[model samples]
Target: MLWDHRRRPHAFAGIRLQEFDAKAGRLVGPQKTIYHGTDLALVEGPHLYKRGEWYYLLTAEGGTGYDHAVTLARSRDIWGPFETHPQKHILTSKDHPLAALQRAGHGDIVDTPDGKTYLVHLTGRPTTQHRRCVLGRETAIQEAYWGDDDWLYVKNGPVPSLRVEVPGTRDDTQYWAEQRYTFDAALHHDFQWLRTPDTDRIFNVAGGKLVLTGRESIGSWFEQALVARRQAHFSLDAETVIDFSPSDERQFAGLTAYYCRYNFFYLTVSGTETGKRELLLMRSEASHPHGNLEMPFDEPVQLPDQGKVKLALTIRGKELQFYYAMEGQELTQIGKVYDASIISDECGGHANHGSFTGAFIGMAASDCNGAEAKARFDCFVYRPVQHYTDRYEV
Candidate 1:
């Protein structure tokens, strides 16, 4: 059974079950409402398990906010008049705002061959005063035990731990190493494009460059040529060299620190009315609804229309700055510092429950006109700065 949010008013997220016909590859029976979490609204992520004589129904509740939790109910029969857990919520980080791992819930239990039980759940790591999650939701595991009381509980009760005692070697080289990418037969596993599966329409790897054909606006619902990689560290540096020639302001190719359509800072190369190619800065603030757009620079910085331009970003905690360089010139700072914290969950979405994804920094190209201008990126580099504190050489 699963909760359906669409069945509102009459059945707000009603957990319903139906039989599936594997041969037909479809649901083949009449669905029936199995449970309604009246007390704890917005219940979802249901998992059913049986051990000995008891059948357990596990669920996530209280929305996907700071108050999210994992609840348990059980009965002897599959069709249950299930009794709720004594504590109701078996796991959560809701009450512990200061906890390193927060928004803990949506979990499932698994048993090892040696007879140990473990619970795997979703969690978030929030940073800054606004409690925004720049790295999005992460998975956490905790040891669990079936008690003499016939109830399952996370070890040390409910709150999630920062680290778990698990058998595995942490790959430090993969975690901290710098990534230098040049596209070939396939897009690197580290990078991903938004919305579409038809990649050839937007980008391709050829002539030792990742060529991005201009699409609609940066945040267009239809499509956009914006490819990005996740931001895993609190501080890091990103650089890319692009060769693009835009005929007008509408045709643009650049680098951006993006969270969502509502929050981002972009640095693009395009043409101005004075018939000159220049670097422009565009930022979208996390406003009430759509967002508020702003141009930081008083005047556009002109660039030669002939060669490759290197764009760079250095993000240290909440501070973000952009840098640029011409073919033979040294990289120099261009824009003022921005509040990089805005590229976080708190500011990424219009509503509290909407921001589930993390921040990203990447390359993009767009053209409002029908013309599909091409932006060829020579290379893209992601270098992690190893430091406990935000301070480090960039």
Candidate 2:
């Protein structure tokens, strides 16, 4: 439910069901209000379930924080007089600090052909003591059963388990490998392009290369060119080979671990007014409002003559390192390790603006002179720590 303006007693003027209308190419036709929470302020993420002659309405409530929970309501008709469950909350992670997953809510019920039901929902894992969620929100599944009173109950009663049993008929042998995007096809759905409103087109892919047209610098609140993907793990290896000739001293293109519009780290290929091209590694923080601090490098190094350079960033624990490599050569460390927490939700301040969006690592290109320079990426490779355990068994 959303509102454009205030309407006296009620927060919103109209209450409508959320649905997609493919014919109109947009979310339209709420049809009618089937259900709402007793505390409407905290109600969202609703899912409909049908059993026997009853239509069950499941909703996530109490905000998307430690107080989050899954509650239910039911009615005989599809659209009226829905009654909240006596239990109020069917699942939650409140008070379960020791549990592997916390802040659990937004559940969806999936029924198998064998009559078994399961609840799949969003959950988070905070660090051991800091209570900072480095892995961000993740999906978890829990088995469900119907009681004699016709109420649905999770197998372990509420807090999700670290070890979940899988169905006997489910496959247990498949495994996943590292992700490598050659840009041989479409950009992976996980990748995102960052830009400001009314920005010009600056991204394209053709001839097996992902090209980005340079615009304003990364710090620009107006039009800028950047493409990135989420940083899903504390330990990960991300690399990309970029090809961009610096026609002017103000042009730069490289890799970055972006947290928000104000916080990030960059390892870019740039040139000086004197025409000396080099790779620069730097970290930007909101606390240091003046400008970014340049990372120390081991020795003097310059960009390759061909303008094709491989840029890599690795995150292990709280340390982040940058590297560079030429064709057919080993990757050489470009600078000393730097703190990786700046690009995190817990850093700078509370959730506001872009901080709540999570961290991302990808390519960035900028031409401060508005020269419309372009940068081409050969490929992007990402290798995250893979967990092999029954807890992630889906």
Candidate 3:
């Protein structure tokens, strides 16, 4: 069984449960609607597990926000009218507003050999007061208890905890918070071209630099020379060194906080009408159809004559600060801080468009003048203030 959404009445509307059967080596069945959440506006992340003679259906209800939660239903048959849990929500962060983790739900259960049960779920740790989760959703584990009535419950009061006691050795030092891409030969595995653009045609890796050919503007959906990685943290510093001199205003390249082609915050470097090199900070607020607008976040500033320039973005809490530096000059702040939430999936109406992916910060190049401009990014570095890891006990 699976859950799918329809965007007719609204974005992320009518999340209906559907069933499919797998035979032999292939999945062969039509989507048959089994359940439609009557009380919830958005229901998703359905997982069915069989325990003994009863079949348990776990579902993630509500939008993926503070109200996100996990609900349970059970039945004897594989497909039938199941009974909802008496408590409604088996696990959630709604009741505990001040908890370290919020937006808790979408979980899976696993039992260890020693009869210990644990549930691994997604959760979000938001900033103080603002309630915006810059780290996005992350994995959290909680112990589970099976009662005599055959009902399962989260053991830790159904709320996400900052610390959970696990019966095993945990070495947090094994995880690294920094990721550096030298582009020595090819793009790193973490780097991916936005959308389904032809990677071989639009990008080339040689001479210890990743070269991106300008195709469409940053706001165009068809083809844009943009490569990005997920934010994955509330506080992080992303820096990229690029060697590009734009010949005209149409050709530009810079660091970008990209949600989509229409919804993005870009600090682009380009040439003015008088052939003077300048840096421009802009935001693209685009919706479906013709509801699109591009606004300048800061006035264009002239750049010093340098062979290579380093662009950096510092994201902390809800603000994003951009910086630039020449090859040897100290990094200088560019413009005022902009709202980092503008690049979030919630603000960009990702649910309305049925896109569940999170935000991405990356490098982009554009040449709307059809000049076939190229931008070379020598290296890219992403250093998170905190490291995240998942652990399991044998």
Q: Which candidate gets the maximum TM-score versus the true structure?
A: 1
Candidate 2 overall Cα lDDT vs. reference?
0.73
List model 3 lDDT by residue over 38-154, tens digit each: 365466677788899998878887777777888777878766467777777888888888887778888888898889888888887665465545445678898888989899888
Task: Please give the RMSD to the true structure for each candidate, in Å.
Answer: 2.7, 4.8, 4.7
* Alpha-carbon shift of residue 49 in model 1 (angstroms): 0.6
- Scanning candidate 2 in windows of ten residues, the lowest lDDT window is 385-394
- Positional deviation of residue 218's Cα in model 3 after best superposition, in angstroms: 1.7
lDDT of model 1 at position 107: 94
Q: How does candidate 1 score on lDDT? A: 0.83
Which residue pairs show collisions in model 3? none
Tens-place lDDT digits, model 2, residues 1-394: 5342554444432234656878888987547766557553456777777789888888887666666678878888777578888777788887687777777888989888888888888776655355555555668888988888777888886888766775777553322347788887777897887655433477778789988889888877777788888877667799999988876569988999887656779888877676677886656775565435555556546775575788998887567888898877899877778877667655534532123355789998999888888899999988875433213322
Q: What's the lDDT for all of these models? A: 0.83, 0.73, 0.74
Candidate 3: regions farther than 4 A off: 1-23, 26-38, 41-43, 174-176, 285-299, 304-306, 350-356, 386-394
**Alpha carbon lDDT at 161, candidate 1:** 80
Worst 10 residues of 1 by lDDT: 385-394
What is the RMSD of candidate 2?
4.8
